[model samples]
Target: MIAEPHLPAELATLLPPSLHALCVTRRHDQGDRLFATGARPAHMFFISEGEVVLERASPHGAATVLQRARRGFVGEASLQAARYHCDARVLAASRITRVPVIAMRTALASDAAFAMRWVAMLNAEVRRLRLQCERLTLHRVQDRVLHLLDTEGERGRYPVPAGLKSLAGELGVTHEALYRALAALEKTGRLERQEGALLRVAL
Candidate 1:
């Protein structure tokens, strides 16, 4: 698993004891439809294990993966304005903590340290999304793929079997096209496909 460097211990501690203590778990495929299109939000989630994919559907019915959340990461967009901006799906069996928005808001108001850490976390997420947008605008698919590997680091290898289609869709490319681009990169020694759908960057 990739280490979450940006999560702050203090922030976790500051969460309401009730929220921090709640236990929620589901099979790998469950919770895939927790959020309906334009669904009103009920609670935010703190993922303790596994990953969740946030996706949005286009008017033409194409689904696009918008983001992925891993352990120690909190999904707070649901707490904002009582409406979810995208659909959330579990990519693997997951343990999550459900935090009521009202409770979270109260805790943040009362805890200065938690508020600061929360702001920092949100800022980091914003920066990451901005970088993704920049990469997606690149003229070449290879460049975009390389940029993703570089940002996610060597351990955050790609071409994951279960998520490849979602990844390609997120990259705005057909799965076949993404595969061809990856093959080209492999031939040039820019990346090596491993046994478990992991792609290691040679650089």
Candidate 2:
């Protein structure tokens, strides 16, 4: 069932009144498929809780994850598409807001303040995707882990190693591969797993 959305007070205040009025907040369970490839763009979403992965299957039948969005907008780039080009999967129980495409377009065209916010959100998404591309260029699992830590951490470390499998998923690798990499790093005294989703780099 779609429940009322829970957005940060500041974000709630920033949403243009018209767009905000049309937004539908709801709860989506894990494994829900919000949209599929080639579907008409119906709504733009914001994740208030949990995660969603934007993935597309390759010609070879392997899934290539384009984005694993935890917060903010998920399909900002597809709001204008006649049909969605990828699958939107919910990876965990989540709160989300779905703003119909027509409402989004209206706000972007008629509301200057909302237009600026939308542009800024799109720019941020681009920067994140670029970083992911750069991370994907590395051949080694350890390199990928370090790259994620470097880009996503605050001072060279994540506080916990709790989500190793999820980490592997984000890196487009299997759970076993991430486990092996973490084990190897531990053997080399390079990384240590700690409590509370913490993974520390041993210096």
Candidate 3:
């Protein structure tokens, strides 16, 4: 069995006491398989650090990533499903909290306040996924980058949460294409990178 790891204490703030008490932290190396498609959904993983991608097979037999998470709950929808429809793969060395699905359901059933918070979190996750889907549909790399700034940023600026290569992947473009897009944007004064990985966009 893979060994569990210690999670950061700050995560306690996001979860209710009932749910937090039931979470067990675990460590996963890069490329670890956290769960497989059609597996019984016995647990929900909350990512504390690093990254994980949730993917499913497309009709063309290629893997299509449905979600990418660096922090927050990775499988919030698993609570409503008996089995997972997508595979969860760790993209970087990670610390994740595993919460027993049964216990989580019981908490939702027993605690009205916690249930509302859980529903709110799920709604926010859906909003984020919708934005990601829209970003992936744009054909141009610069359009994707600009859309990210508009949707994910404030005041025409967005912080780079991960490496540029990873961001390119999330934007559904090759790293080289994304690099060219960034360069073009910089040259056109449409975007600029500041010292702290902060990207400024001219809307």
Candidate 4:
């Protein structure tokens, strides 16, 4: 059996001793296998390191990445419903802390702080999804790219971390189309190409 890793001091305090000692494994997954799939309320995860890509599959077997979870982000919906509504896959080598569904519910029922924190986390997820929907519905490709840079860029200067191909995939368009859109943005003063990352709309 694996020894449980230390949780953030704040989080650890909220959990009962029964849960604090629970083991969390580090894993790397390729392609699509169910780490958590559909609305099943059985488990919850706290990502300690690396990234997890959350996506929903279409009826035709197409998967669209909804968001990428970095370190410290918690993936909890899995343990709430009957099944997971989306799929979670490790984008790189990842360290994750797992908590059994029953433990989570018991904590929520007993610890006010834990319940509040969980509710806050859920609210944030909802807001993020709403923003994504707004971007997909109202923003043009150029606007989306600009917005992404504005939101993700560090300081006023940062290289475009993701390539046009990846950007296109996220935006649900062809790479050529994204390139054309980027070109248009480049022609204007909205975007500037640096050595690697493209600087956008100065911080």
Q: Whose lDDT is greatest here?
A: 3
Comparing candidate 1 with candidate 2, which one achieves the higher TM-score? 2
* Model 1 deviation from the true structure expressed as Cα RMSD, one decimal place: 5.0
- Tell me how many clashing residue pairs each candidate has: 0, 9, 0, 14
The 0-to-1 C-alpha lDDT of every candidate, in the order given, reads 0.66, 0.76, 0.80, 0.64
Error of 4 at 131 (Å): 1.8
Candidate 2: tens digits of C-alpha lDDT, residues 31-139: 8998899888888888866778899999999998877777678777676678899999988777778878887787778889888877786787678779888998999
TM-score of 1: 0.74
Give me the displacement of residue 10 in model 1, in angstroms.
9.9
Task: Report the Cα lDDT for candidate 3.
Answer: 0.80
Error of 4 at 117 (Å): 1.5
Score every model by TM-score. Answer: 0.74, 0.78, 0.77, 0.65
- Against the true structure, candidate 4 reaches a TM-score of 0.65
Which model, 1 or 4, shows the larger lDDT? Answer: 1
Error of 3 at 171 (Å): 1.8
lDDT ranking, high to low: 3, 2, 1, 4
- Candidate 1 off by > 4 Å: 1-19, 23-27, 37-40, 48-51, 55-75, 154-161, 195-197
lDDT of 3 by residue, 83-196 (tens): 899999987778788888988889889988877877787788779889989888888889999888888766876654446877777888889998899999999888888742
RMSD values, in order shown: 5.0, 3.4, 3.6, 4.7
